[model samples]
Target: MTDPQVEPAPTRALPLVIAPPRGRQKPPRHLADLSAEERAAAAAELGEPAFRVKQVAHHYFGRLERDPANMTDLPAKNRDAIASALLPKLLDPVRTMEADQGTTRKTLWRLFDGALVESVLMRYPERATICVSSQAGCAMACPFCATGQGGLQRNMSTAEIIDQVVDGASAMANGLVPGGPGRLSNVVFMGMGEPMANYKAVIGAIRRMVAPAPDGLGMSARNITLSTVGLVPRIKQLTDEGIPVTLAVSLHAPDDELRDELVPINTHFKVAETVEAAWEYAKKSKRRVSIEYAMMRDINDQAWRADLLGDVLNAYGDWNWVHVNLIPLNPTDSGPMLNGQVFTRSRSDDMREFVRRLEAKGISTTIRDTRGDEINAACGQLAATE
Candidate 1:
């Protein structure tokens, strides 16, 4: 059963910790960051009735209304004051690019402080999905990502993160997009930063996305996915949150040697530890953890590597709940470096062979469709570049 011609896989040793950037920048306060009681108290302090808080919440969350003038149910004179006191403009669209017959639109947003973050909305026959950024840029120095090249700017506030979704929903509601009026059915936190790194705001955004009308967008929790580059402690903490949103682990390699180089953070928490954390999340949430593997040329695309990966995942013994999503690395704006290159797209034959090897071992696998490639909207391509 052994392929003697192929070289043996290298031994994966636990790597030493590579310290991450210290001192995170805090974002400004917004209404979405407040709890329900706090919102009511704020309204009361503003001389508006306590019931007005729920009314305004309905306008923003349930109705997807952004303009204060459009809330005709409120007093015309008091509408602006109430909205100004509670809701503040967060994201201003700088540029929006459309591709794939205009079904995929990517927006470059300028925050209040002029920091840029990007979000993409794609429409399908039955569903429309919006990819929202949790931070202005990324702290994870994944060599293949354009976002990581610039380093982290700061973590986005709860309202800033939720505004991306509200904007997409508003676009769909007003028929601004090509595919007629439709609701946003899915939200994925895979745009610019690692969701797990911005734990508080990201969790708050999830709660708002899942809570019913007037309190949240009322989207189903199951439709939202939070991806991380394997932050072990946060992965365990998320299990107790009880939201049950799908957790996607960006595990590019099964072995630690290559992973430590590609995902520098891996040096801190090795491959086995990361996988175990993911399994714990799966057990608590009862949601299958998606293993995201980006295929590159001869680097990590060998058939033998696929077998090794399968063996690693099989070690967890929950073969039924874990799925492998193979992503063909998108060519980033950043060129190849001695450490690694973002432009190294894997060959088709090698990718197929890798998938075949995994399937042969009884592990479920799928190749992700690289949507919005023309507009640089694929995975790891959100660098806020024009």
Candidate 2:
């Protein structure tokens, strides 16, 4: 009798191509997003125990990348297969750049596909935060940000996005980061792309973030913030997701004229309309909406514009529903090589006084301490260097 031959089981391969029209073809669904039952079904497909799905999740979530071998929990063969299905190829750190007294570290990761996306790990005395990228490159052409300047290459798979967090969490848990073994308490989708544009996967990553370990990563929703440059309808959509993450709107200007230029999307959805939608989201989410104002010199940085900003926000019915994050313009590579940002032209302190005008009117305000400027890691600055 001739020896019988067996074929190798199929594995997942992400199609690397220019993403087709978003509606024409569905983006490749990742196994990370599936429910427990679905994960069991996937485990069963690999000729492994359905229960091993939970064990694999424990490897990723409960232990925070504690080696499956270290689990001492699952049978050898099953642990290997389970780890392969979920983590697959992990992101190895290619470069680590730090600034702000080692409190902020921006890691450039090479995915299995070799696509370069950056994530930032920032430390505050009370909390450690991770800023994650939702897409590889951004399509939003915000002239000030390097990532936006690169243009959109592709959206990250859910696993690809979530893994950045898992990797960061693991790094923190293992004392690999500056402060040893501190918990990662905050997640921000403000690093690379317009997160709301990659709606589905971002939502999936959020669900995975808050779910209890073994079933999910178990991070709190309050510690996570999903930022967007005023994508009106999507802001409306997030209200239904029922997660109470604070929403940060990148409203770079108070009026349509400058905003139309600074934030191009303003041309499509006017400032008034955007804030109204933000208001709806605030009411539904029952959380304060964050308005991100990028201060540029002699460009939307006028005292009149400040007063107008306060008035416009006041028109939203109550100033208490909104707060503004004033990001002083970080220098970009376009100006000079080493000292890239042209801060000589603008003083952010002047803008701080403008924010004071809003605070004078009974509105809440916070001047975000600038971090990671030395590494070209500030918001929108990543794609610039890439």
- lDDT for each candidate structure: 0.79, 0.72
lDDT of 2 by residue, 221-271 (tens): 988989998888899999888999989898878889878766678878999
Runs in model 1 lying further than 4 Å from the true structure:
1-28, 332-334, 338-343, 379-386
TM-score of 1: 0.91
Where is the poorest 10-residue window by lDDT in model 1?
1-10
If scored against the real structure, what TM-score would every candidate get? Answer: 0.91, 0.87
Query: Per-residue lDDT tens digits of candidate 1, residues 35-131?
Result: 9789878987889888888888889998999789998988998999888777888988887888878888888888887778888888888888898
Model 2 misplaced regions, further than 4 Å: 1-31, 333-345, 379-386
Clash pairs, candidate 1, are none
Number of the top candidate by lDDT?
Answer: 1
Task: Give per-residue lDDT, candidate 2, residue 198.
Answer: 86
